[model samples]
Target: MLAEERMAIILEIINEQKAVKLSQLCEMLDASISTVRRDINSLADMGKIVKVHGGAMALDDNFSFIEHNVEEKLALFTEEKIAIAKYAASLIEYGDFVYIDAGTTTEKMIDFIPQKDVSFVTNGFTHAKKLAQRGFKVYIPGGEVKFVTEAIIGAECVMTLKSYNFTKCFIGANGISVSAGFSTPDVREARVKTAAIDGSRKAYVLSDHSKFDKITSATFIPLNRATIITDKLLDKKYTEYTSVKEVL
Candidate 1:
């Protein structure tokens, strides 16, 4: 397996087992002790795990959305999010109508988009304001506002999303896995994301590498529904499930 693939499995194992011995990681990844050590070190630097003397420990549960607000999350992976968002914005051509999902990473995209005639539709309160301030044509669906996420989510949002067919969609998710697909902790937001993907001709999931191999509360899209754009393509195995592009 590739280093990226090995790292992903290592994370999955650590998350499942809580703590694992170095020898166990080597046996599971089917690699040498030196190789496993290197992978553990890398994941540690990313703060994805805790490195013990002879093994690694999982970070506190990162699969929940209720724990952190957008303001806090924007600071978590700024560099990675910026890189992935820039690539997602680059895919938007003039005259294209795009749906930008409510997310910390997805919201950063507004700063990087070139001044062009592309229109935007969003459920994020912050995202809509940022896009409007940048002088882009922006639309917001009618729905009940969820203050925690600052997003419009409900039956109304889904209704508005269905009326317009988008050229492309830039989405954000709480977690993702081949088995569970794209997911978030809120079911209402999941409905909005699902509608956005279905309404767009092309769909791109923008997330940092930290999101891979994780499953959250609700599934929004299957792996095949959207192309994955991330800071790193850890596992080539991801390509077997869907299209994945690494920006950093």
Candidate 2:
């Protein structure tokens, strides 16, 4: 395709979605990665689109930050959380060693997790208790518990995660952005989430569609580092970066 044609299509996509990842552009244009990247650079240089860390955004696109405590978050997306949690739980298999992150959605997963020969490690105090009650072997790292989120954080927890190689991990994010990746409000908690993802063979970010396009204080992992499982995906461009499963 001609450079002019590709650039025009790219601009139209950005305007429609408010942002576009380079990978998405490459796929949509049926062009090579290098070609798409060069096109993005040219567009950025001409002041037609704003280039970000891993993607381009419309000039008027806004990046906002906000955080809510666990209780408040739990009340916001109740049904979506259940559906997302149920599907996530279905992915677990017997003998799988899993790391479960602390969040309202992930908490719901504990109930749906099938009765099997599976083991779990978690930073959420409530998550640990729930798993143990179900007769599953559960481990909790030694760390200072953050009151607002009720999850364990700090270097100690990170160190503990480093020793385990989990088969699968379910994580939570405060925000999911193509440009900024997966983010959380606290740097310490982000460190814990990063460690878990790095130590696991496979990682999944459990979030509702409400988290999309938002950014937070600290980014734990990049957009491509893990698959996202959400209740709904408003923007399909996210699939250009990594795998996304919409349980709805």
Candidate 3:
């Protein structure tokens, strides 16, 4: 098959599977492993997909593929995410009900959350556990656990989230684009995110500069739907919609 044909098929598979391994791609395309690697490399260069250790993932502009891996995610933009999280944590008040979405940035916020009378709801197993262990009134939306990200998502999670009304929600995205809006790789997780946004009175998206101008499949919400809390280094192109907050 032609390179273009192979690339098109690769994109199609990524859309359906959310991720694809190098070996699997070679088998599906009837191409040599080296050829598939070249295709993946080319796609990564074009920003069409993100190359992971053993495979590639759909390029979700709001969040990087790195964000899906717990350890690597925690290391990336560590200082910046921590700063953003601290700022978001400051917005929470005692006795408030808050919903925290899944992402490394939102995870950082958990540590900075002040010890107070607050109820927290989440679809992220890690975040839920951390908050629950920290003495916060934490509620976990029961659902299937996506092992790749440790995110709980599905119909059950969405249903559970819909029953609660949070005073504020701090959401995270895989990618954010003016045109594509906020997106995540997993469609199920996107549904959970939408539910969280709908369940909250006010929604704030916590993202670092790296998340800007990225377009991921499965948009959960439009960029205009929520207030964005991000670092000032964000691309100037996003200045119009983003509430850029400098992390001192």
Top-TM-score candidate index: 2
Number of clashing pairs, model 2? 0
Name the TM-score of candidate 2: 0.76
- State model 3's lDDT: 0.81
| Candidate 3: clashing pairs of residues | 60-216, 61-175, 61-214, 61-215, 61-216, 62-174, 62-175, 62-176, 63-174, 63-175
lDDT of 1 by residue, 92-137 (tens): 8989999999888889889989999999999998999999999999
TM-score of each: 0.74, 0.76, 0.72
True-vs-predicted CA distance for residue 45, candidate 3, Å: 21
**Model 1 lDDT-worst window of ten:** 59-68
Q: After superposition, how far is residue 195 of candidate 3 from its true place, in Å?
A: 0.6
- Among all windows of ten consecutive residues in candidate 2, which has the lowest summed lDDT? 58-67
Summarize candidate 2's per-residue lDDT along 132-175 as a digit string, tens digits.
99999999999999988989999999999999999999999988
- The root-mean-square deviation over C-alpha atoms between each candidate and the true structure, in angstroms, is 11.9, 7.7, 8.7
Error of 2 at 106 (Å): 0.4
Name the lDDT value of residue 6 in candidate 3: 88
